[model samples]
Target: MLAQLLCKTGLNSLNLNTKLFVSLMLLLAMATQSTAVVAQTDRLTLIYVSEMTEMDSEEKGSYPKLASLLEHYRQINNHLVFISGGGGLAPSAMSSLDMGAHIIDLLNAIEPVAMVAGKREFSFGEDVLSLRTYEAAFPVISSNIFDPITQENLDGVNDSLLMTVDGVTIGLLALLPPIAHQEYNLQRVEIQSPVDALKQRANELRSAGADRVILTYSCCYRDYLNYFDELDQLLHDGLIDLALGKDEHLLLADHQLDQMHPAHIWITQGDEVAVVELTLEKDAPTFLMNWQTDSMNAYPADAQVQMLVDGYIQRLESLLNEVIADVKTEFATFQTDVRTAENPFGNLLADVIKAHADAEIALVNGGYIRGERQYQIGEQLARRDIMRELPFRDQVVLVEVSGEQLLLALENGFSQIEEIKGRFPHVSGMQVEYDRRKPVGKRVVSVRVAEQPLLPQQTYRLATRQFIATGGDGFDMFGDLEPLRYAGQSNRLIADILIDAIQQSQQIAPLNEGRLIDLSSP
Candidate 1:
C-alpha cells in the first residue's frame, strides 16, 4: 500500500526515483508475498525547500504543486518531515500581500520541522519576524545569530532541533551565513562566526545521541569544499549522516553523484525539491537523494496550496493591483546594471535620495535595489512592483561628512567590484571615474561633487539609507560623520520617497550620465 502511494506520486528526479523504487519495490514485493516476514525497518524521508523569494510561488514559482505533493508523501510516511533552508522570509515587500506572511502560511501548511535563518530573514528585522514566527508551525533556527539587545539567541529561533522517527534519532542544525554581521546590523541580534557556531552546535547534537544529523547550509555558492573537510570528517566519524544544502551553483549532476559520494546533497532552489529517503536498518543509516531541480512550470498545482494562494491573491488584489506609477521609458534593474554599472533605476534611486534628504550628494548601494525582474517602458508599476524592487524597508537619512570621508567612501564602494556585491555605490550630485584594473582599496581615479573637485576640509550633507548610515556593506567611513540624523524623521522609507517622486514627475527617465566610469571595463 505504501509502495502504491509512492509509485502513484513519482519522485522528482529519475536517479533518486530509481534508488527509492529499487529499495522500496523489494519491500513491496515481500509484503505482497505473505512470506515469513523478516523484521522490516521503516523508511524515513526528509523533504526540503530553500531560498524561496517573493517570486517563488504557484503564481511566480512552481504551482501549488509543492504543498500537496509533500502532503501526499507526509500522509503515506509517518516518518516523513519537511524543512526549509530559511531564505523565504524576507524582502517581505515583494512576497504575497502581507509581505511574505503568506509565504509563512504556505510553509506552515507543509509543516516543516525546522528552517535555517538566512541573510534575507535579517532584512525583515527581528521584531517583525518574531511575531511572524508564531504564525509558523515549525521552529526557526539560527546557530550563529544572537540577540545583542536581549543578550540571548534571537527570539523565535532555535539553534537546532532533535527528534526520533522510526527509532532513528535525527538531528537538524541551522547555520546562518558568515557574512551576516558585515552586511546587516540589527537592533536586536548579532551574528557570530558561522564556522565556530556550527562546530559547537554539531558537537551538542552528537552529545544528545542523534543517530543521523542534517545541516541546513544557507552558504550555498561559497567554495565550501575547501572547508567541508570538517563535514567530511564528521561523515567519516559517523557524527553526521547527511548535509542538506541549497546551492544551485554547486549541485552535482545525476550521472556524477555516485563518483563524488558527496556527504552533502545540495538542492537548487526555484520550484524544485529534494526528497531524501533514509533506509533504517540495524547498521548505519543509508541515504538515497531524490533531487528534482527542473521543469517546475510543468508541475501541476496542488489543490490545497492553490486554495491558500487564491485566498492571498484575493486579499491583496486591490493593493497589489494598484498602479503606483506609470512608466514612460524603461527603468530596468538587471543585476549586471545594479552591481557593475549605472542603470535607469539605480540612477533614479540615487537622485531620489539626494533630493529627499536635500543633501549635496547621495550614494546608495546598488544591492539595495533588490529583485531579478526588469520593468518595461509602458508597463504600469504597481505597488507590488515597487515593493519587490525595494523590499528591505530601509529608511533615508542625512549625514554631514568631509570631502575626504566622501572619497574614502567612494573607494570602499568600488573595492569589491570583482564580486559584484551590494557595496557598489550608485551616486547622485557627484561623478566618479575609476579604473577597475587598479588594485582594490585604490580604485577611485577621480571623484567630483557638485561640478567641482571635493575639498578635503569641506563638509557637505550626504543622503543614504540607514543600512549604510549604520556602516553596513563596508562603508565604515560614513559612520564617522557628525550631526547625522534622518532628513525628516527616522520614519521616511526610501521606497516611498522614490514612488512619490515618480508619481509627481509623471515620467521616469534616469541616464547613466557618466556618474561612474570604469576604464578597465569595456
Candidate 2:
C-alpha cells in the first residue's frame, strides 16, 4: 500500500492539472499496489565460502566463531553453508590419528556446507582422500584433475554445484591449488585455462537458468587478486555475477566490484571480518570483524559437523602413531656447506649416484637441497621428513656428456660460485679450481676426474634429478644430454642421506674443499 501511494503521487505530480495532490491521492494507492505486485519477484542469493586449515597443538589458535557465517546465512532464512579448505590432517601431522579429529571438532562447531581441496589433502595419500571425500556431506569440487591411466576426471566429485535460495539461483565452481600440481603431483586432472574454462562454465550455468555464478577457488593471495580482477571486470560488464577468493592463512583485503555493478569481493577466516552489503548499489561491502549485536556467535556447533570431526580425528591419530622411526636424540641444527671446492654433503650425494649408476662422475646442484638448513644434535628423521626438504619430487636420471658438456656443467656451477649465491656444484669424483676475478666462463682454470685432465671429446656419465638435468634454474644447457640411464629413484633425496647420516652418527660437520674460493695467485 505504501509503495502504491508513493507511485500514484509520483505519477500525479507529472500531470499539469493534478495540482501535485498528496493526501487526497490515497484511494489510487491500493490500485497502484495491485499492479506493482505483478512486476518482478526474483532475486539472486549468495553465500561465500573459504577453506581454513586447522592449527597444530603448538599452534592451537581458535578462529572467529562459525556462528558468524551461519548468522549471515540465517538472515535470509535461506541455506548457505560455509566450509573449511578440506579439514583433514595437516601436513605436519604426518599421519597423526588426532589430526583429523581435532579439525572435525573445530569445523563441526561452524557447520559449513562444503570443502575445497588444499595441498595438505594429499599428505595422507589416496585412502585418506577417499575417506574424507565420502565423510563430507557436501561435494568436493576439483575440475582440473584426471586419472593418469584412465585419463578421466576422478569419480565421486562434482565439477560444480547449482543451488537456489529465495528464488535466486547461484552456481559454485572450484579450482585446485597449482602447488598441488607442482609439488605434490596431485594433478590427477589437468586444469584447463582458468579464464576460458570459467567463461564456458558460466555460460553453461546461465543456460541452465542460473541467475549468478561465483568461484570459490584454493590458491595464494596474489593469484586470487589476479583472477579476481579478471572475473570482476567480466562480471561488471554482465559477464558473470561475482568471484570469492580464498586460501590466505588470514583474511587480507576486500575489493568492491564495479562502482555501478551489483558485485562485491571478500575474504574471511577465523576471527576475520565478514563483509556485509545491505544493498546491491552500495558503494562497498561494510567490513564487520567485531561480534557486535549485528553478527552471529551465540549459536553452538552443528551436531552432524561435530560427529564428522570426531571420526576424522580418531582415524588420523591411529594412522599417524604408526611408528615410522625410533630415534635416540633430536638434532638442534645441521649445517651443510655444499658450495666449496670439496663439498662434503654434495660429494657424498654425488658419490651415491656415481656408485648406484656405475657412472664415471656425478654433479648435483646445491639448490636441489632447498633452503639447505643447519642441523642440530640428535635430530631423528623419517622418509616424509626428508621428502619435505626436497619438495619437487624430481626424477633422478643419468646423463652422458662430452668434456665440453662437462665443461659446461663446470662453468655453470662455477658461474654460480662467483655470479650466483648458491648455484655452485657439490661434486663427487672430481676436483675444480677457478679464478674469481675473471669473467664467467673464463673462470674455471682447470677441471679433472681422478687426476686425469678432462677430454672435451670423451663422454662422462652424470647422475642428477631431472629438474636441473633438464635446465631448471638456468641450467638449460643440460636439456640435450645423451641418456645412459633413468634410475627413477626417490628412495633417498639428497637431504635424506644427509639427515640420516647426521642422526645416526650424532656428529654434524661439513668442510669446504676449496672448490671455488678465491686463491691469491701464488
Best by lDDT: 1
- Among all windows of 10 consecutive residues in model 1, the one with the lowest summed lDDT is 4-13
Candidate achieving the largest TM-score: 1
Candidate 1 all-Cα RMSD: 8.1
All candidates: TM-score = 0.84, 0.52
Residue-by-residue lDDT tens digits, candidate 1, 1-522: 122212211011122224333544654464445323323336766777777764335433443776656656656564566777777766546442354677778775655656677776766567776666656655667767776666657666666776655456667777776566667656557777655776777778777766666777764645344345565566566656677776655444455455433556766646667777776543654654344443345556777777877776677668667776667776567566798877667888888888887889988998887766766777777777676688877788789888888888888888877767778899999888898889887888888888898898999898888888878888778765554654365575777778788878766666668888888877
Put down candidate 2 lDDT per residue, 333-405, tens digits, no spaces: 1223444344554555566666666677777776555324444344444444444344433445678888888
Clashing pairs in 1: 57-61, 64-302, 65-302
lDDT of each: 0.68, 0.49
Cα-based lDDT at residue 63, candidate 2: 31
